[model samples]
Target: MAAPLSLRAPAATPRLPRLAGTIRQPLLGAVAVALFLLSWWGATASGMVARLFLPSPVEVAQATWRLLGSGQLVAAILASSARVFAGFAIAALIAVPLGIAMAVCGPVRAVLTPFISLLRPLPSITWIPLTILWLGIGETQKVAIVILGCWIYILLATHEATRRVDPLLVRAARNLGAGDLTVMREVILPAALPGILAGLKVTLAIAWSCVLSAEMVAAHNGLGAMIWEGKDWGDMTQVLVGMVAISLTVLLADLVATRLERALLPWERHRRH
Candidate 1:
């Protein structure tokens, strides 16, 4: 405080760390993955890891290459992707309207809540027995499982979001000569969109998992079937590759959803920092 050399000394700025925080986790993750692969290769070579149970990274890579070249993997991937899209789209279409209806019609929500609560906890696999009996073991049944998986999650999310949207916005809209439909369109939907999108993002991953499970039986082609067949033959390499593909696919989907959320919810984002 005593050393005032200049009338206007420059403001001091904190120096940035040598490593950026954003990339620190990614770098660490890469190193950890590399070490895991090295250890896996060593264990397989040393006979500590049985080939039937655990395959080397190189073996999994070779299996992936072979599946790709054979075109079987392509067919499986396409079939699974199609089922996922169809089911997920149907779920969104159904859930959004139902959620809105529940929000607007209090009695309707009260009536449905109990039934939905009962069903929501049930897993997609549990529905297989009933679905098979109700519907044939075909694309419809497979798609149904995915829809069942997606619908409840989106519905609950939408309902919660709608409830969370400020009531003052609705009152303001009504004060300005807005009808119920107008209020919903102008206030409720827009306000709840971010949460709804987040729910959809979560459901997309669930739908993928459901579709894989659905493909376990009766499906001639799909990633789940491929994995099942691999397991039946004790081909751990192929099983590992398929599992990796599924995980990577879900991660890519999550990334896309995050990007979409960022694009759509820019206002919420700006408020954060």
Candidate 2:
């Protein structure tokens, strides 16, 4: 017979190189930003839109520099950032433990679930008037707004994360003579950490937005207040500068959280790779 066809598996196709997880991805992101700037510059240069409505990127940059030189940008950033972190920290301290308790205790869940459900859908802005009335237009009110905006979401996320812990793992720990607290401390908490961290990252963003809203309405200084002032004066450049500052701050916060998540859950990172 024709020397019998060689019995062998087909050769696998060579995989194409991917840009993902490579330096090229960041380079490509830079390229995209450059293109956007170019287009924006072109639009402004060509007079496609009124400069009054949309200031050029250079104008926005110069405005940012002016604010920085005057120390206004720095102060606003510090004020807003402080409010965000303060509220977020307070929420985390309460919500995380409460969430864990709800997961582990039936009575706790029964007591909190209805209230969470009732209040979770309310937007942070809805609380502004009430907060001003109750807490006065002060830092306390701003921080409380952030807390009200973030805590329920954090609690819900923690609850879901706790619930998702595999029952088998808990059982195995218990069978090894672990008490409920031991099981929770050693097994459940680690398992739920990733989800909890992700939730915190999201809640941080929400906190920022809430603080901005609070500042816009009540505060004398903050990026949000800067934007509001700019709007009142019809200074598009100042408004754009505030917008950029907020965007950059949020981006940096997200990056920090992402790095922390990777550090805490190296196994998850490796598994994905």
Candidate 3:
């Protein structure tokens, strides 16, 4: 007989490096962004771009730094943020309950569905003329703009998520003696939390966009107004600085939303539960 077969199975490839890569990639990306900004600054400082239109990175940084050092940045941030929050809060307040009620009640759903269908596709900007007519160029107008911008998205998200709550879960809740309020609170909300929260994230971002639209019309004090003023004055550095500030604010808002989701979805966090 030939020598006994001595072949062995191939060893498994290591997964640690792949796992590490997942974490390393974002870190590398962040580092790359910082490096890019640094290089951009160097180029600008060296007069790579015309100062009028494309201000040197250093000039933009200086403008931003000065704004930050003063309270102007803070005031603009607060004003824009307040508009966003007020509008978003109003939409959420109305949408969530309305969505749940409509999903659970056919007659109510029939009554409202037509209106939501008609209104949702109309751009928020389209409402600006009507809103200004109704609310005028005051805080009311700004809030209305934000509201019009965000309301449809919030309503749709809430309605769809509510409607799509798993039938099995609803049945299970009924079988277990859960009532409407309890079922909604315990089963439906939890089940739809992820989707609803996801919608909030989207709406919040849109709220940011809407706030800018609201601010640009005639607001004396907002980041949006700041940008417009900067442009009119040919202060490209300030304009770019405003853009950067908005971007940073959006990123920070995303971070807060993520943390809020993680905190609220305890069952999601603990999969075993």
lDDT of each: 0.88, 0.93, 0.85
How does model 1 score by TM-score? Answer: 0.88
Give the local distance difference test score of model 2.
0.93
User: Model 2, range 1-273, lDDT digits (tens) per residue?
Assistant: 578787899997655455344767889899999999999999998999789999999999999999999999999999999999999999999999999889888999999989998998999999999999999999999999999999998999999999899999999999999998899889999999998998999999999999999999999999999999999999999999999999999999999989989998887896655
Q: Which has the better lDDT: candidate 1, or candidate 2?
A: 2
Best candidate, lDDT: 2
lDDT of 2 at 14: 54
Q: What does candidate 3's lDDT look like per residue over 120-204, in tens digits? A: 8877778778888888878878888888888878878877888898899999999999998899888888888788888889989
Better of 1 and 2 by TM-score: 2
Deviating ranges (above 4 Å) for candidate 3 = 1-19, 38-49, 270-273
Sort by lDDT, best first: what order?
2, 1, 3
Clashing residue pairs, candidate 2?
A: none
Model 1: worst 10 consecutive residues (lDDT sum)? 13-22
What TM-score does each of the candidates earn?
0.88, 0.91, 0.85
